[model samples]
Target: MARHLRAFLGADDATLARRLTAAGTVQAVLDAIRTRLSEPARDALVAELTAATGGLLEEDLDSILLSGLLGYHGLVDAARQTAAEQDMTNLVTLDHHLVRVTSEPVVEVLVDRQQAYELRLALTVTFTVQGLAATVRAGRLVHVRIGRCSADVSLSWAGQALVRHSDLVDAPLVIKLGSGVPVHEITDPADDPALARGTARVPGPRVAQPGS
Candidate 1:
């Protein structure tokens, strides 16, 4: 009877025949069937089979085997959805109208010993207005701004503060300038010890000898 149902569900004909021919394969076939069914269907089938057989079984049984298969399917679907969302979120359209200038050899400066020097950098940015208006370039500087700094600096694009720099002198003297852009300038003082640790340090205040 189960063999007929297995055939109706498209189970391989040879495999079904082999299972039906062996008494030891019956339990294995039943386990395989339960794993392929969804939760509701599995429950319904289990109820029908148990009632028909009058609750005769030789070992403990659990729904976990079926539930695990469904769980595996659910996980696969969730992973696909997350990957799709990530792809959509990361999609960026390039703007082909802006000219960008990047300066290399990011400058490092030290202000003084014990106190780190803080600098406010200002960039005189020039854009080829003609290129942007015509969309002739492959890159666009959609916006320009300064990141955090230890000291405050007044910024102007033709006199406007696109971005403000703050917190330059804080601990961890290193500062990251901007996101997805290059830094134009970094200012540091000449007397910084971290910058000149290899140089000799001047002697501290000397006390006159009592004998002298």
Candidate 2:
């Protein structure tokens, strides 16, 4: 299970997390994010706000109010981006050191499936489903065995099947496998095929600050 624990760090992941977490309330974080928007974005937001308020917009808008609206907009954009990443089956972040959502989705799905398998295995070990079962053993999902009472006898043999799926694989060296393994890689849309895709897109995470 420890091996399964992985984290992804895009640009400002630490700072963004800290800012968001340290805030006393969610509203505070939203306000901080509003000030980070570009001038054009800010003006557009103001215009949008004016339209929503039906021309009675305050001559002097409250900064906190304005930021609350802007922060909502930013969160909306972030959600859209997250959805796009899922649709693309990729989450490309700048830091190569951290596991990209793109890279981990496949493995994550595999680990999740194990939970399902564990439930089925429990039924197989006992004729009746009673009590609780733990999928992980000794901080590792491998060789997981679980049962209580009569089920314990069956688990001794049946629960040995669960094991962690390995992510490693050989490409340049293969034996009777499919050719051109497709070396799945990420690239920004702006990057040309001839150029390294890695060099094209910048990665950064959003950080909101406390209310100004």
Candidate 3:
């Protein structure tokens, strides 16, 4: 009987409501069933009904009364709370990180040769913290703080690569170059005796110089 009751109550909302109405008025049907059962049997059946309904049954009702009242209420409030917490746990925020470089005269030749010339160059400098990560929209900045700058000089010029982040400012760079040689190098005059040491001035942005 409990199984049949559960099945009837589990029907779609419209079917359950129609069957409940056709059986007789809900209160009249429950009163008839309650009068037929003994007190202990009725109490035991109500306990079973309470358990079957997951504690949703009223304490005063017999099983038949509860069975008559059964109606689906959508999701349980506890289940909804758990689902909300799970969604919060699944949410995440992404972090942002990027690299950049900035400088003046976006493109410039720090050194140029007339006809054909070849010579070693050296760079000694300190870079501003801002300069290291500043955006580099165009061209490249080479540091020649250490080692020999050697290249062949000719109409068809050859260039040499400079060492970057080398602490040894006095180190010489050797390079081989040919005619019409063009080289771009960075140096801190405050660190180079030949450039006449003084407070170094930071250069601002400028249009690319002609011939650069």
Candidate 4:
């Protein structure tokens, strides 16, 4: 009975599409945005303390910025894991058939210190797996590359605007997906879109950093 249902569902493109759609596969990716991306963004903001901004206001600003990036990256990591899990489930349920999976994740990071400092990051990450199901089932290296990611970053202190980047999309994040290939990560400079284009925005007047 179960086999018959699976066969009936997978027998045609329209049936398969409907079955996949009803399974709410994309929703799994969305959930990962909240579960996985927060830590890196928050951690990045804390790392900004390397600059030692001094006064309370400066400290608040530093915290917001570093933490924001940390949380963003963390979320990206989680999303990658979730995507991989979804792919694995698809492979098992659908056999070795190839399928295209796509998800657009929109995340907003807001770190506020009352009236002292505030950091807001509106980010959109386009995650896609174009027929990697076959490679995955065959135990081969699969590249799960993010399509296009855009970020609108804004920072404000004492009711004043400091820095802002609207629709910054030069660097796109990519995750190498497969067994023994390391989970989704931005380790390589060539693979890290955020590092390749530039570091995420930190609160302050945009000044030239040494390597940025």
Q: Write the per-residue lDDT of candidate 3 for residues 30-84, one digit (tens) a residue.
A: 3534345445543443333223221111121112211111111111222234344
Candidate 3 deviant stretches above 4 angstroms? 1-29, 32-35, 55-212
lDDT of 1 by residue, 106-154 (tens): 1111212221211122222112211111110112111222121122222
- What is residue 40's positional error in candidate 3, in angstroms? 1.4
Taking all chains together, each candidate's TM-score versus the true structure is 0.15, 0.13, 0.14, 0.23
- Looking at model 4, which ten-residue stretch has the lowest summed lDDT? 50-59
What candidate 1 gets wrong by more than 4 Å, as runs, is 1-96, 100-113, 129-212
Clashes of each: 8, 0, 27, 21
lDDT of 2 by residue, 13-122 (tens): 34323322333222332253433545554443333322221111111111111122222222234334544453322211111111111110000001112211111111
The best-first sequence of candidates by lDDT reads: 4, 1, 3, 2
Off by over 4 Å in 4: 1-50, 53-144, 177-212
lDDT of each: 0.24, 0.21, 0.22, 0.28
Instruction: Return whichever of 2 and 4 wins on TM-score.
Output: 4
